[model samples]
Target: MATAAVAGALGLLWDWLWSERFWLPHNVSWADLERPGVGNFPRARHVLSAFPLAAGIFSVRLLFERFIAKPCAIHLGIQESVPHQAQPNAILEKVYTSITKCPDGKRLEGLSKQLDWDVRKIQGWFRHRRNQDKPPTLTKFCESMWRFTFYLCIFCYGIRFLWSSPWFWDTRQCWHNYPYQDFLIMFVHHLATIGLITFSYINNMVRVGTLVMCLHDSSDFLLEAAKLANYAKYQRLCDTLFVVFSVIFVITRLGIYPFWVLNTTLFESWEIIGPYSSWWLFNGLLLVLQVLHIVWSYLIAQIACKALVRGKVSKDDRSDVESSSEEEDVPTGNKKCPYDGSSSNGANQVNGHMRNNCWAEE
Candidate 1:
């Protein structure tokens, strides 16, 4: 207990020093209440304020899905065919853990020779072993549904709210707000979004910006819906939705977005706002978004080609595998985590373990 106390104190002190001295800009420390006064929040940490509302909404949605959506899905025969999942024994588990946790491209052929198994079997074990980290089908459903609901509502709200603003008529109002948000990658995405909205509003670029946001939101809605369908075992429906998603994503992101949005922000904005450093920052971030769009588009195309050939998609490539929503905007993350088969009794055990990565990879 005494050791723990000392360790805790040291850890806290290190955190304080690190955050205050190294993390903050100009070594600013949290030393004040920031002139507590009228129209300002109290000088107390109250980050909990937004959490409850979000929690309540989540709870209600979960409850509704439990009592409503899940039952409907079950009745309609929408279900995943869960084969008996297997767990690796300690020694084998250790091997898998080391490989996945910090892979160093150790030869699977050598591992296969060591285990007295085919290279394909070794590869299969590792693939499914890593897949074990994927989120379950139900969690994926709820997440996709939540995002679909949010983007749909936000798109509608953005349209309604911006219709009457002066920025709708003029191109210079967006410069007035000059909102500068500094955030990490995830928060940078949100900042970029707010930047897009604010600048579009300021520079009378709303006409193009609003359309881009709507197009993005629309594709997002379909993407999430497709994931929900995928989880529900509605392969046909999932395929249909994915096809539409691919089509719209291509049309909007590749065609309309690059042309319309880039023209307005990069070309037209320069004409109105004139040249500035921030313009480069703004357009640079926009290009970052475009790069992401193109990368995801490649995945979409990858799947589309498979669909054309096989009439359906049965698996995904590792490159597109997601561990969390931080890597993507729509309903994407780990899919169903598969595992290895159990060994048979005694001497024949190792020989009888399942030995195939049956799913085709292109």
Candidate 2:
């Protein structure tokens, strides 16, 4: 904790000493805060001198790099290995071989089952590959470009907000003839706008992706649950609720917010009233949408958890059946050959405890 505190203090000190040199005009000075548009630095000396604020900001970046990014990379690596690792199982191998030998509708169902992934996900991958073969889809490229622009805008706007304040500016005193309080407010407002847009975009993307994955999983659950008299109605209700709430959250996060931001009449009102007057209204709506999203996410997670638990229980039961029936099994030829029907002997090879299955005929 002490070390973290030290690191944070150092970070803030570093920001104080160098931030102005890099971000502010050379002509600006500490005295500029006394000007009309500038802010008062004298009043912020105590808070800016504290250790907590600096530590908090530095810790966030540290947490992202150390906890989030590393874990996400590991998860992605594991996911990438799934298809290769599962390739040797006879059922999986057959599905793989069929997919590689066919195209479009001919392979869709087999590939979908083999991959244990949604058809939409497989279609997306195929679309991405096809787009790679060409110049790339204009719409996708434009969206990516806009996303990059938005990220850049948010980053710079945040920096501006931090530096514009008297509390922050007093440390380095950058900016000439600018009042500290007013410019600080403007900077904060801009930061808020950028943050809102970035968050909205991310939420929209996650909501859409989640909804698609949920629909696929729900379909599978419905089919499986139909075989169990007690589970069918409950599963159907869960699926319906998930779809409905997910749609609502997506519409609010993506459609409403973007529409509000883009509307000329709204923009004019916001401009006339100023950010201070409109901040509460805008942020309030976002807060409500965020709450709805949280609720939707919770529902989805609950359904998934229940499904996973049931699947594990079913798998255990199947394993018991296989074990109990082992002594009564009929004699058969090589376990791999007739089941896989693979021309290549390589399909029978095992890596560790897993069988190899390829999505293509080798």
Candidate 3:
């Protein structure tokens, strides 16, 4: 929290300088929060607009995924992984759960001696044990669908808001009257703005919140799109989006939000109104957001490293890959595998072995 607070503060500081928050409201105080304003549309009324907007995009994405992406995935030969026969051995499972997941050489050696099996078989068993943890295909589909909808909805909403609002586009209007000296609060500010928009819409702060959401949501489309593309087996397209997403993420999230928008919020708002208990709450929430971004940045760096050195794009590099060995079995080059086109009633007999092996029957 301390670290996050510092990060938020620094982010706001950057925003303050860039936004020129120092030049407004020479002697702003808490009393100013209640100062009546006129001419602004009831921000609360517009808050409800987000739900319908999100729903519309969600519908479109679902339709597209079902009709387009699923077919595309099938055409490109990417289907669900072949499920391994589940072992219901309670004692063996208990050993796997209580002890190290991947046993060390000595432990493996001991286990092999006890089980009267080779070390390789023990390793393969452990691999299958871990494989049991793989999520169901439906679960992955739903998760990806949720992300796809959220990203698409947020991106479209952001654009709609930007198009409707002249205040954001007109630079001459901003900092026309302000005072400043601030740290970055861009990340948490958006989160709080969204909360406030949903909860305290009457506060008339929802417009600011909307703008914050817009700025941040800018890069998210590419991130989710890349993952969806990967799932659809659009590997080349996914690779391109992954690269673009990284650049956009750095530009929008790491660069502009903290330096530009946070400046507007932190330094500008403080001068307009004095500190309240809610101020503390708001800042604290913002700090939490900054911490999350920093954490995700670590994962993003890993992705970048893999892209640079390994020359491949990964959707979820943050988590350990299920089985690097299994993944590696697909080969390292741009070499594509030809799908064995055996119909439902038939099996592809490749090199005298049935290629469409079903281990689940075991």
Candidate 4:
């Protein structure tokens, strides 16, 4: 369905560009091909114009797979790895280990240190167990952005086609010129825009799903980390934030309310009000919704950044401990332990003190 919409939109755009009188060789007639003119390469030009449309479709598909499908898989993989019936201590160990070994290894390290865990054990977990996959790379993210932008451009073209429709024009008391060439132009442009918007909307839905999954998976990790650290406060805070943002993300993306509102308004307008007035009101509401959507997106970004930073800090502290321990083990033969007198006892005391102090800080 999305493909068909996009194809239709692209076709409309192609016709519009060709038929509309503009800077680029205006008044080119598609019907003129049968007349055998001196400069007749209509078929060739038409075929050539399609290349960009085809490329645009392909690019959008590639991006959808990257940002949406792949991220969801990563989140699910992490969620599946959590042990359900494990001991609290065992769960902690597993959580810590998984954090270190997972693709978001830095975050795990920060989390371990924040929770006061043995970094070596975390490293061991990473070495012995495989993590789910990594999230999509920045390149993929950029690609997705580009694809969405392309869709937006196409959607604008669709707006132009829809705006010029006879139904709209007549109602608006605007000029109603439906010449064959112009009609063909409008039709092709509308087709392209519809196709692009359809593709974009589906991809956006997938992205929303992926984000929800990530929030879910992150919550589980935080819960286990909180348990290990006995920092119930932080855990609760994170959980609340995640849940709230996740809900917001899902609601805005699904656009359930806007759809209903639009439907209601359109129905009322069709029955009693005129088409022009109905369309104007609908467009106004759409603009408002678009603004709200942008604001929601910004909020989501802020929350995600906060979570990532918190996780990274915790992991970094864990790595610091492992480094300190390795330093202590370096043989300083006959040297007194830094914390006590007798060399052997001193070394043991120093190591113990280091571990205790680290855990106490947590």
TM-score winner among the candidates? 3
Tell me the spans in candidate 2 whose CA falls farther than 4 Å from its real position: 1-194, 197-277, 300-362
TM-score versus the correct structure, for each prediction: 0.55, 0.21, 0.58, 0.25
The sequence of per-residue lDDT tens digits that candidate 3 reaches over residues 88-135 is 655457678987375778887887788787776666566567666765
Whole-model Cα lDDT per candidate? 0.50, 0.33, 0.50, 0.36
The C-alpha local distance difference test score for the whole of candidate 1 amounts to: 0.50
lDDT of 2 by residue, 1-362 (tens): 99999999999997775343332224544445446654334322332333564466456645654465445434433111111112133643454355532246646777777768666455444433332333212222222233223334443544454444442323212212322323223322222223333222212211221122222222222222222211122344433433443444345434543353223223532443233322344345545544554554454444334444553211111111211223234342323221131221110111111111010000
Candidate 3 TM-score, C-alpha based? 0.58
Candidate 1, 282-327: lDDT as tens digits: 5776787788678666766666655557676453222114333332
Model 4 deviation from the true structure expressed as Cα RMSD, one decimal place: 20.6
Q: CA shift at 298, candidate 1, in angstroms?
A: 3.6
Q: Which ten residues in a row have the lowest lDDT in candidate 4?
A: 353-362
Q: How would you order the candidates by TM-score, starting with the best?
A: 3, 1, 4, 2
